[model samples]
Target: MNLYPINAGNFKLDGGAMFGVVPKSLWSRTNPADSNNMIDIAARCLLVEDGNRLILIDTGMGDKQSDKFFGYYYLWGDDTIDKSLARHGFTKDDITDVFMTHLHFDHCGGSIQWNKNKTILEPAFKNARFWSNKDHWKWATQPNRREKASFLKENILPMEESGQLKFIGLPEIDLLENSELGFDVFYANGHTDKQMIPMIRFKGKTICFMADLLPTAGHLPIPFVMGYDTRPLLTLDEKEKFLNMAADNNYYLFLEHDAHNEIITVQHTEKGVRLKEIYTCNEIFN
Candidate 1:
């Protein structure tokens, strides 16, 4: 199997929101904020090419939203799914599956796009089957007030409307081994309900797509949960368990939201799990 790190786009998010109650003095050291108190964030999606199936993990925020809506996020960079795919000699139409970690706008927004003339919303990847679990599908479609803003209808419904939406059955336990997408899926609930973190084995290494469960290397500490998480206490527990397992097993964490650090391996230190080494996508994936 071959893997590619797809750069969808980059944007800025408030450091306070990204790091939760963690003091700026602490988080700013690793994820230094700009003058506006915003930190750089990348919509670093992952592409898996196994046999005939080309699966895209997330699509980043699409370009369909209005300028006013996007201005709030301080969008930056020239990266787009199209350009990134072309870099690998592929295109959106070449994708067979779009396995969303969760339905948060930044993770799944690029799955749908505006039609020509802006008449109606449509599936951005015409040939791809959009993937999400039943639990998350329900949670995103019927979002609570706390997360309503992040679950946009324009970014989701079109997949089902296009008759290309598929659901991955939730595992009875925390992890599902060898899923339909040909990888183990570790279910995480603290970030959002039923967030599926893909554990892919390639080139004799385990590469885990660390969605919001561990957004950046700075979040390696168990208590450094994102403010956006609905259940911060649960996130602490999940991170502690996952980080320990990653450290013990020497898993290569593929960070999706970390603009600076692409991949990292953690080790158990006196201060608990801490970043052991940072690697650019080229260093690991290539």
Candidate 2:
């Protein structure tokens, strides 16, 4: 199996929001903020090439929102799913599965698109089967007031309407032994309910797609959790346990939102789990 990094684009988010209660003095060292107090964030997705199934994880925020709506996030850069896929000599039609880590706009919006003339919304990848879990599907569809803004309907409803949406981890199992997508699935509830983190074993290495569970290397410390989390304490617990195991087993973390760092590994230090090594995707696999 081959893995590739699919960079959708970069956007700016408030450092305060991204770092939660952590002081700017601390997080700014790793993720510096601009004059407007915004930190760079990447909608970095992952592509899995195994046999005939080309699975794309997290489509990034699509370019369908109105300028006013997008103005809120400050999207930048020329990267798009099309350009990223084309870089690997592939296209939307070539994708067989879209494994969404969660239904947040930045993660799943690219799964659907506006048709010619902007008359209707449709699945962006015409031939792909979109993957989301039942719990997250409900949590996103009937989103709570706090998270309502993050879960955009335009980015989600079309997948189901198109009859291409498939649910994984239906029983809400700890680890989905066989997802039928050639990867084991684990759920992290701290960031959002039932956020499925895909654990892919490739090239004799265990690579985990860190989808908000550990957004960036700066968040390696257990206390550094996102304010957006519905349950911050739960996040602490999940991160501690996950990090301990990751350090012990030496798993390569594939970050989704880190702007500069592409991948990293953690080791148990006196201060607890800390960043061990950082690598670009090519540096580790190529």
Candidate 3:
């Protein structure tokens, strides 16, 4: 199996929101904020090529939103899914599956796009089967007021409307071994209900797609949960369990929202699991 780090785009988010109640003095040290108190973020999607399946794990926020809508996020950089795919000698049409970690706009927005003449919304990858769990599908479709803004209808709905949406059945426990996608998935509820974190075995190492469960290296601290998380206390418990397991097993964390740090490995320290090392996508994936 081959893996590619597909950078959909870069944008800035408020540091306070990203780090929750963590003081700026600490989070800013690792994720330095700009003058506007916004920190850099990457929509770093992952592309998996295994045998007959070319699967894309998460599509960054698509370009379909209006300028006014995007301005709030302070979008930066020229990277697009098309350009990133082309870098690996592929394209949108080449994707056979799009496994969304969750339905948050930043993670799955690129799955759908505006049709020519801007009259209709359509699936961006015509050949890909969009993947989401039944639980998350329901949660996102019927979003609560706390997360309503992040779950945009335009960014979703079209996959089901196009008759290409598929659901992965959840396991009775937190971990599902050897899923149909050809990897183990760790289901997380703190970030969002049934957020699927793919645990992929690549080149003799475990590469975990650390979605919002651990957005950046700065969030390695157990209590450094994102404000966006509905259940912060649940997040703390989930992080403690996951981080300890990650440290003990030496898992390579593939960070999706960390613009600066692509992959990180944590180790047990006096302060708990702290960042042991940082690697760029090239260093690990190549």
Candidate 4:
């Protein structure tokens, strides 16, 4: 299987919310903040080319929201699925499957787009089946007050409306077998309700798509959990368990939100699990 990091775009998010209760003085060391205390973010998606199946792990926040709605996020950069796919000699139409990690806007918003007439919504990848778990689909569609803003209806709904949406069953491992996509998913609830994390085997390495579990290398210290997580304590435990396995097996963590770092590896250091090294995908695969 071949893997490519699709650069969707860059945006800024409040550093305080990202690092939870961690002091700015500490978290700022690695993830520096701008004047507004907003740290840089990348909506990096993963593209997997195996056999005839071309799969996308996630789609970044699309440009379909109203200016008033998007202004709140401070979006930046020229990256988009169309342009990024061209960089790898592909296009949105080439996609056969869109595997969403969760329905958070930033992660799955690009699944749909406005039609040419701008009269109605259409599935962005008309040919691909949009994948989401049954539980996450329900949680996002009927979102609670705490996460309502993040789970925008426009970002979803259209997939189902277009008749391309499908739900992945429980026991995450079966997803790979069922679809023949060749990657296992790790279910995490701390970040949200049953957020699926992909564990992919490629080039003699286990490359995990670190959705919100380990947002960046800075989150390696264990205490740096996100305030948005519904269950921070559960996040702590999940991180510890995942990190231990990552360290023991030397897994390559493919970060989705980290602006600078594309990939990272952690080690069981004297101070506990910490970043061992960082690398670009080319450095590891090529």
**In model 3, how large is the Cα lDDT of residue 228?**
94
Tens-place lDDT digits, model 2, residues 104-150:
88999999999998999999899999999788899999999999999
- lDDT of prediction 2: 0.92
If both were scored by lDDT, which would come out higher, candidate 1 or candidate 2? 1
| Model 3 lDDT per residue over 1-286, tens place | 9999999999999999999999999889899999999999999999999999999999999999989989999999999999999999998999999999999999999999989989999999999999999999999999999999999998889899999999988899999784579999998999899899999999999999999999999999998999999989999999999999999999999999999899999999999999999998889888
Q: Is candidate 3 or candidate 4 better by TM-score?
A: 3
Which window of ten consecutive residues has the lowest lDDT sum in model 1? 170-179
lDDT tens digits, residue span 70-130, model 4:
7877888889989999999999999999999999999998888899999898898988989
Off by over 4 Å in 3: none
RMSD after Cα superposition, model 3: 0.7
Candidate 2's error at 213, in angstroms?
0.2
lDDT values of the candidates?
0.94, 0.92, 0.94, 0.90
Ten-residue stretch with the least lDDT total in model 3? 175-184
- Model 1 CA deviation exceeding 4 Å by range: none
- TM-score on alpha carbons, each prediction: 0.99, 0.98, 0.99, 0.96
Q: How good is model 1 by TM-score?
A: 0.99
